[model samples]
Target: MSNMLSNGISGLNAAQVALSTVSNNIANAGTTGYSRQSVQQVESIAPSNGKYTIGSGVDVVGVQRAYSQYLTGALWSSNSSLQAATTASGLTTTLNSLLSNSGNLQSSLDTFYGGFSSVASSPGSSAARQALLGNASSLATVYNTLGQQLSQQRTQVNSQIGDAVASINTVSQQIATLNGQITVASINGTPNDLLDQRDTLVQQLTGLTGASAVTEGNGSISIYTSAGQTLVSGTQSYALSTKSNPYDPTTTDVVDSAGNDITSQLSGGSLGALINYRDTTLVAAQNQLGQSAVALADSVNQQQAQGLDLNGKQGQAIFSVGSPGVLPSSSNSSGGATVAASVTDVSQLTSSDYVLRYTGAGTGTNGWSLATTGGQSVSLTANADGSLSGAGLTFNTSGTAQVGDSYEIQPTRDAASTLAVSLTDPNGVAAAAALTATATKTNTGTGVAGAVSVTDANNANLLAGAKITFGAGNSYSITDGKGNTTSGTYAAGQPISADGWSLSLSGTPASGDSFSVAANTNGLNDSTNALALAGLADVGILNGGKTSIVQSYANLTTQIGTAGSQANADLTTQTSLYNQALGNQQSLSGVNLNEEAANLVKFQQAYQASAQVISTAQSIFSSLITAIQA
Candidate 1:
């Protein structure tokens, strides 16, 4: 009977334990990372017949909690991917906005170039030139503004990377601390709510650095990078730092104490995305812009040098000379040269009606005298056959010459060398009785020593049909009377013009050659026109280059998109897996409230019945004692 009562008490205890487990499961169902738990019951054993045993009554076995290692691992993995994708996508969208083709820098360049082209076609119109200049100024402003914006974006990314690293370190430390607490709690068989907190910390760490988690014995977990770098291990966390890349100081990257590219090592995270954008997409765009500038400068200079201007000037440079697109070299001794020319009176020069001449020293045995002492000179002469001599002396041919070099001339042995001259006053009519002069070599040698002089100056005759050729090739040619032909190469003198237009060569023309004329006359020499044209082409070409750069950016963004989608999908799948695992665990561990309540009623009835048995036993014993006493 005592055994029976004891057995009944055990059944009562088991019922209560079941109820507690069910209530606990219901209470924590909504809690994050809380796995539902339940109690297990088993029969107590009683010895019988010395060795054999029989069931006595129910006894509480053990309490189990719901958990699945696989599900938890999946959750951590997905969280990392999700974090990385979000970071990349957000930044790329901003970049795309900045680089968009429509209404962006590219459009600004188009307007600028269009304005220059309009000016080139109408060089005589001041309004057009002014408008072109305005557009050019605006274009420069646009370039500066765009460059600044790009720089700012890079800065922003760098700032974000710093913040992310800090956040990562904080979470890592938290997780490491939690790992210690969880290990102790699990060993003591205490509730592991702190472990759940630690898990949350790990998840947050994954978002920042794409860290993975590994469960250790006794409910402790260690975190590592996807590449297997230890992040958190047994209450110890390694730190991350944001530093400028040694190879490229313009950008920042993640590293440990020792510098290394941990960007690619990070599989998925915001920090990785930011690093990639700065080093690859942003830097390439800047380089492309620089390249476009160079290409524009070079091509325009080449074409402009080949065309003639309004002043009948040929081989004149249109752009500034000597590779204007390159950044100045540090070791260069000479300062950058400036080519400056201005028409004080616009009325005096028209785009189609201007003369360009180099004013410099003359070369040869008897160096020709310059029109102005101590300045460069280009002599102009006329030739017979109605062709002028020395017209070609105005162009540059061999190498680049600076502002103070001279060109010399020698006598030629051809009949075409006789000179003819023509005089034209402001009224724009050729003089009828222009004088012609016969040129004779006073001292002649094989170009090594030659002295030439002009004699028989019938001012009327010489000026009538006499012409001078500046150099070996006729750089300049003037037509003379009815059909008189005369030619003589230029010795030395200022470039004389029938029109009021004059040019100081600053440097010499080649012997027998004229200074190179730049076509598309904007008036400033040294291929300024070519520079303008090249600047226009640069607008188009650079826009194309930028398009390519943006495409690469898009490709990177697309990768982010794919990663983000996959991450989100994984998260969903992980949630499902976790829930299913929890359900299975709950089946073994969770307490059913309704079932527990029913058991409560049954156990109460059993306890009442056992009490009644004890009361009956007591009453029988008391009656027997009384009978014995009587």
Candidate 2:
């Protein structure tokens, strides 16, 4: 009977233990990192014929908690990716805005080029020239502004990197402290909440540098970089420093005790992305801008030299080829090397033939003269190959020309045509007519019989609106509004007229001089100039309208747009993968409220049964005592 009672008590105790396990699970249902626990029961040892044997009554063997190592590892890995993606996406979005189509850089370029185009269409208009200067100034202002912004972003990233490095150090220190606590708890068989805290710290570290954590046997974790560099081991923690690279000061890279560069080894996380953008992406974009600027300046200057202005000056360079920071100065000695304008075709030259005259007399002359004793003249011929060639010329050569000694090429023609000019005197004479005139006749075959004639009926209107045509077989005609024609075989360096406008062909006319009919007579007030300036289309900037400043600006916009789109796509894909990983981890480790509630009921019933068993034993013992007394 005693054995039976004892057996009953054991059964009750077993139920009570199970109830306690269930209750503990329910109580910790809302706790983070708390795995649900369950009681495991086994049969107790029994005695039979003085030998021990398995008992029928149940006993609590062990308490089992739900945990999966694989799930935990997946969670940590995903957390690293998630942190990195978020950081990279946020930074790229801001950078994209700074370099986008709506950015100030592109706008400034448009305004600057538009101003030049405006000047080209209305060469005689001072208002247009002033507008051109204003646009140039604005463009410079915008470039400086954008450059400063880029500098500021660089500084901001540097500061952020420093902060992140500090955060990483702090996290490493905290993890080391937690590591010691975890090791002590594990040794004492105590609860490992501190270990869980260490895990949380590791997750935070991952966000900063994409570090990974490995839990050791003693419950301490070993933290390492994604590339396997030890960050923390046992109770020791290594510090990280943010320093400028020796080779590239603009870039910030991580360093350890040995001062080895670790930037390339770093992958993922906010710090990695910041460094990557600063060193690679942002730097590359800036280099692209530099290339575009050089190409733009070169192309525009080439085209500008080809076109003729109101002053009858063939296209002089509109932009300097040197660094943008430098300004045009009168001191030729200090100007470094002057980039000579390249002429691709003789048609690019204006009809004006210029003679380089000695501008300085002896050592004290203030006025220019054609004396060769002071300085020799240079004769420039506009060749059909878009190049200017002159004989007996020395630039920057001492004793050849002094400061303030003028070398001027005065184009003789007011006519709009592609022509070549050759200098007669290889050693240019001052203020001398450098080109000789020749005449050819088709109708009379006489020396001066078919000479080109001029009719300046509206000579003032000549500069205003005039057209000259060179026909086949060396025949040319100048026609006025009244259908009057001056027909002759056009001679090189000869003067002709139409509608009172005096036109001089001072150079060898090329096939490119064919006149195109003027569509309208709005003159300086024409909207065509404005439209061309606005980059609506190419307007005679390049041969066959092949290239324009507007096109360069568009290309820059496209490049930035493409880079931004790629960055966004990468961010999105990484985020999705990270979320999926997190979901998988949650399935294995996360708490279920319904399961906890069910456990609560089970534990409550077991506790009640244990109490009833004790009560029944007490009643039986009391009844036995009463019977003995009776």
Candidate 3:
């Protein structure tokens, strides 16, 4: 009877606890990050008899939290991928829309180039020249607008990066706090709710920036970034902070708690996406656009310099571009060095930034090394005048450089931002060639001289002009506008050269036949230079002179479009994968109300049955006591 009573009491206790666990599961069924709980049972043993052992009623050992480390890890990985793709996709789309507008660069460029043709039709028309100038101004405005937008995007991205780092730090601190609580709770029993909270925080951390969670022996978790930086370990978490880049303050870099740079190491979440896009894609597009602006302005300015304007003076630059940007490392010694870069060959220029680092005096390679930001080495040539020239730029240093001093030279990154029409007056438009050549009407044998083209606007004898008189053996004598005479041999279809101009003579020229080269004094009727300027629309002027201005813009548009399209596709795939992983994770840990309801019935019945047994034992005890007393 005593053993029966003991068994009944043990069974009732186990059943009550089981019922409580089922009720708890039902109550928290809709809770986020909640895992279903169940009772773990073990048989309570009785002392063995001489001949046989007896069994005891059930004992509730613990409440087990249904969780799987493998499933949860998969979910975190996929979630990180999805977030990164989403961020990149959104930015790429914005860039594509910005550059793909038909009315942006393409339309403005066409209008500007076409204006030259209108001026070529009526060289002396003031209204036509004014319209051409307006077109030029509009072109410059378009370049300025695009450059500003790109720069603004970079600034926006930097701001976002700062926000992400802040978020990661906040979440990390919370997880660390949870870790300390969980480590203590695990000593008594499974800290189910606390573990759920920590895992939730870890997932959020991963979304902002990728992280991996490792379960420690004491029910705590250690978190690491995808780049292997320690984010959280046991009860402690390291904080991340943003700092200005060493060379470019407009750019932001991430640093670890120890003041180490980790900007390049974070490459897995939304934070990584913003940094990568700003540094690589956005800046490259900006540089390419600036390259186009530089090429257009420099080409036009060079041509304008070689011709004569309406006032019969040499043409000045019609466009002005911003100079290259130079930034020295912050760690350099005070007044260490300063570098100014100038574009020397437009065709040889690339859309890349260069880093010029001084390796110390007496070092090989002229004490300095040059490389692109992408890590490709660039060959630098030392000119006789002590200037360094490479990749279409000439770098002149004014101050002494320290051994580790470095300069970031962005050759064309800001050119578009400062592009402007330098020639503001309509009368300043260069409309005529600097000189002209004409054959005398007395020439025989079908000999004729083509139009003369200016070779050097600064030539002292350019306006002096010349007369070429054919002599024996196809030789020619030149009497220049200055009354200076010189002689040279000429062949059919070969040029008769002057001090600043040249003209081709075709067919036979009898001896004593003369052709004259003189300044285009009657400039109003000549449209030679304007026609040449319009022809620039078709001339290859970029990428080693194999791509025209229009084609260069097209390539930039195409690159952005392709990147945007690919980003969207990657985002779609990542979303799908993340969904699948999340489903797998939830299936194992998520609470089911229907299942808990059934458990409620089962445990309730068991409790009642165990109570009946206790009641029976009590009745038997009462009757036995009554019989003994009678």
Candidate 4:
């Protein structure tokens, strides 16, 4: 009877523990990181005679959680991916909106060229010149505004990066604190609630930095970045930090607690998206915009220089652009050369950055080389003036350079931000050609003269006013103002070029028929340069003559739009993946309230039955005692 009572008591204890566990699971079912737990039951050891043994009911061995390490890890990984895609998509959408907005670069460019056409129609009209100036100012303002907004976006990203680092530190410290608690508690048995808290913190860290968790034997898990840098180990947590780049102060470096740079190794989280967007997409867009600004300004300025303004003076620069940005490496020696860069060929300029490194002291086939960030090197060619030229840039060195010295060259990155209309006065607009062509009065040929055009603006500098004499059998001769003459073969439709001026003869010309091209002295109302300016809208003057300015800007908008679309698609896919992973984890570890309610009734019935067994045992013992006394 005593043994039976003891067995009943043990059963009652086990059932009560199980009921408590079920109630706890039900209470925490809706909690964000809580896992449902249940008591593990073990049969108690039985006392036995040699031939027969009796059962001893049951004992509670431990409380075990419904946890799958694989599922939890998959969830964390998916969460990181989803967050990165989301961050990138939001930013790209903003960029696309700005690019596609009304009154943007494309609109401004159209207005600018329209103003040029207006001036072409009325070259000597002050109203037309003033309108052109206004349009030019509007164009410059557009570039400036876009540049400022991009800078603002970069500032926002920088602030967010700082916030992410702070979040990482806070979460890592919490995880380390929980690690200590778990390590101590798990010496007896793993504490279910503490494990939940720790895992939640680890997941938060992963969202920020894409960190991974490694379970240790003592129920504490170690945290690391995807690159294997320890974030939290045992009871000690390492922190993440940011440092200002010495060469470019506006840029920052992400580092670990030991000051090891890990910026490139960061991926698959919001931090990774921020860094990638800032470095690649943002920088590329800025450079492309600047490239367009530089090319447009330089080409127009050069053409303007080839023409004469209304005042009969040479045309001045119509726009001002910032020079190439040169940043010497912080590690360069003190005696390294002072390098300056200038654009040599606008057609060859790229929106990419290059590094110029001085390998050693040599001339023709030797010293310096230019390379992209990917490490593909280009050989440098030296000009007669001892300067080096390559990739549309001329590098002039004022002093000797060390062997390992390097300079970062950003050819057009600052152009948009610093672009402005330099020609403020309406009278400063150059709307006339510097030279004109006319058929000689005494010419007896069937040849008719078309308008003399400046085919090569730079080549026009060689002009000293020349006369062309047509000969039979497709031939022509030129006589300069100095009376020196040269001869060349010509076709009726082919251009006759001499002293930088070019003109084509239409129809057949008899031998000895003459034409002349001379400096324009009566160009007060001339519209040749204005016409040329208007023609810029259709000319392939950018991207090595592969795209016009308008086309280039349109292409930029298209690129931004495409990138935005891709990012949106990726965000959708990643979000679905994360949701699926979360659901799978929940299915394995989540608590069901209905299940807990049924457990409550079963445990209550067992408790009652065990209590009745004790009551019966007491009744039997009391009766025996009474009978013995009688």
Residues 1-630, candidate 3, lDDT per residue (tens digit)?
777777888888888888888888888888877888888999987788889977777788899988888998898889888999999999999998767552488888889889878888999999999999999998998899888888888889999999999999999999999999988888899888898898888888888997888988877789998778899998899999999999899999999988999888788789989888988899999999999999999889877766778888878888999999998889998988888899988989989999998998777467888999878999989899989889999989878888998999998888888999899888888888877778899887578778787766668888887788888788889998778899888766777777878787678888889988887887787888888998888899888999888888989999998889999999999999998998898788877788888888887888888888889999999999999999
lDDT of 2 by residue, 67-153 (tens): 566776666677667776676667667767776423476677667666656655554567766666566555555544444555667
Error of 1 at 530 (Å): 8.5
Q: Where does model 4 exceed 4 Å of error?
A: 363-366, 444-450, 455-464, 468-499, 506-514
Judged by lDDT relative to the true structure, which candidate is superior, 2 or 4?
Answer: 4
lDDT of each: 0.47, 0.53, 0.87, 0.84
All candidates in order of lDDT, best leading: 3, 4, 2, 1
lDDT assessment of candidate 4: 0.84
Pick out the ten consecutive residues of candidate 3 with the lowest summed lDDT: 96-105
For each of the candidates, the C-alpha root-mean-square deviation to the true structure, in angstroms, is 18.9, 15.9, 2.6, 2.8
- What value does the lDDT take at residue 609 in candidate 1? 65
> Over the stretch 293-336, how does candidate 1's per-residue lDDT look in tens digits?
33333333333333333353332222221111112112223442
Candidate 4: minimum summed lDDT over ten consecutive residues — where?
A: 454-463
> How would you encode candidate 4's per-residue C-alpha lDDT over 392-484 as one tens digit per residue?
889988787888888888898778889999998887788888777888788777788776666565653444788888777767788888887
Give the Cα error of residue 23 in candidate 2, in Å.
5.8
Number of the predicted model whose lDDT against the real structure is largest:
3
Using lDDT as the measure, name the better of candidate 1 and candidate 4.
Answer: 4
Candidate 2 TM-score, true structure as reference? 0.61
Instruction: Tell me how candidate 2 scores on lDDT.
Output: 0.53
Error of 3 at 414 (Å): 1.7
Alpha carbon lDDT of residue 268, candidate 1? 68
Estimated TM-score per prediction?
0.54, 0.61, 0.93, 0.92
TM-score of 4: 0.92
